[model samples]
Target chain A: MKSMLRTETQSKRRWRYVYAIIPSRKEHDFGQIGLDDENVYTIHYREIAAVVSDSSTKTFEVLDYGITHQQALEKIMKEYCVIPMSFGQSTTEGDIKTFLSRNYPKLRIYFTKLVGKTELGLKVTWKIDTTIKEIASSNIKIRAMKHQIEGKPLEKTYRQRLTLGTKVAEELTKREEKIASEIFARLGRISADAKMNKNLSDEMVLNAAFLVDKTKEQDFDTLVNTLEQEYGEKLLMKYVVAPPYNFVNVRIRS
Target chain B: MALIVDDLLRLPVDLGMKVLQAIADDADAMTLKTERAVREQVLKTQMQFERGDLPEEEYRATMSQLRKRLDEVKGV
Candidate 1:
């Protein structure tokens, strides 16, 4: 019975859940910060190491553990140029070592490229009513249409009102694109690379991530501040320093 | 009885096996497609929550439902 239990336990083995890879030759422990408060540590191969914690679960609920995974990477990022793995990556220690050995050259290249760089996110949104009003007052065609439809019976001015609404929407989209392009251009010049993410809502004008060198972070901050001041309350901007989630996603299949 | 057995042996077993294999392959492909779609939805939900489009309570409720669906699809 003891032998059978031992074999059963061996069959249901634990694996290392990897969070990120860093360019370090020495092994280090980050301590009980992983999922379920497991001891997070580094598994080393040559000059690269994977920050990981022991896990028996093969699949993780991303909604529950996603924040923990990101937080672990963020903690490591303060000291290391981290190449983040997508959530729920787990494998045996031997497989991890073999993977690091096989992909050392490529991993080194990513490390070199991403060193001293961090990603910053900026989102800009405007009030739809305010923006539509602004557009209507600025565009002569739209303004004329609004005037022609004003104070008319709903049934009588239905088609005219529809046309006016479409015109305003088109102008709103055009204005959004124009502003987005200008903002992207200004930030892109100072960033090593920039990606435009999809806008979540109609009110959103821009959703973008910029990979900026640590040296240029101050300049990026100043530019964002200046842009906010320039737009005032017309545009609401949310900016945050985040991990390079958009830039590098390392996947290892075992 | 021998004749019946002979007739059964002459049936297109290879074609039946091929059909079965194709169905299995299709099922695997469908699972992969569903997994990809669900993952994308999960990401979209996360973004919606982060952008403050959904309140925390609603976000958690929605995420819990999605997590259940994902677990079902994964056979977890």
Candidate 2:
């Protein structure tokens, strides 16, 4: 009867959706501020605690619930060094305890690495037409080809057109690389680490995440401002401050 | 009643048809590749569910979105 009752109780247990893991010796209850506004709390094991909330289901809506997850991590980050989990990280309380126990060493390493650290994003895009025009003017062969292909039927000069297109693409890649590397090197100097992300669109030239020290936030901001002025209209820069950089910081499956 | 050899043969029409067939084949290949990608995503999402790393509703929505993208690529 005792064993049967234990099995029954385990089967009836609810799952918790995890938002982030923090190194804490004590348990905390942040209250009903998580996704679905359920009672958010922690499940502590050893020296780490998973900041979580009661979840009705085993999955999460990525975009809609993503905002809630981000908010919870940001809230926790204010008071603790959080290793932010992905948006859909849901698990039972028992599993969370097991996960923490198994990954305690890795978790501790991340906590040490991320102490007083946060992620910042920088995106730079250039006006498409202007960039194309600039490239065409600079490359003599491309300029000549452009003039030669003008008003010609594609069927007749298709090969020449293809070649010109390839050449232009190569030139553009070279230019983008030069610019991207300059920015990467400059930003990498002031940050603990950096990750270059794929551009979302053709116009975007740089999409990077920097794991920066909390103390160097101002320095990073000033550098971005200076670079923006230096690049002027050639590059449109956007800097996102105070967001989790899971791409660089989170070690999946660890 | 007098038709030129080029006009009578109508080579462009045959070439045009061949081009259309090639385009159809290319589109089919693209659709197949996208379908495979969707399948892989579904499997990954299922693993997330088993580990309680993802919610069921979110999985459904994501699968639906992937299906929609596949339909678009297939031009359906």
Docking class for candidate 1: incorrect
- Candidate closest to the true structure, highest DockQ: 2
Every candidate's CA RMSD: 17.2, 9.5
lDDT top scorer: 1
Candidate 2 fraction of reference contacts recovered: 0.00
Using Cα atoms with residue i matched to residue i, what is each candidate's TM-score against the true structure? 0.78, 0.70
Write down the lDDT that model 1 would get: 0.76
In model 1, the runs with Cα more than 4 Å from the true position are A1-12, B1-40, B43-61, B65-76
Model 2, position A149, has a per-residue lDDT of 68
Instruction: Give lDDT tens digits, candidate 1, residues A1-254.
Output: 99999877755756888888999988888989898788899999888999999877767777887667766767887888888776678888888999999999999988887888988888999865456556656789976766666656768866665566567667768888998999999999999999898886667999998999999999999999898897765688887766676777678753
> List-wise, what DockQ does each model earn?
0.04, 0.05
Tens-digit per-residue lDDT, A104-171, candidate 2: 88878877878788777778887554565577668889778767766667588666666766676678
Candidate 1 residue B11 C-alpha distance from true site, Å: 70
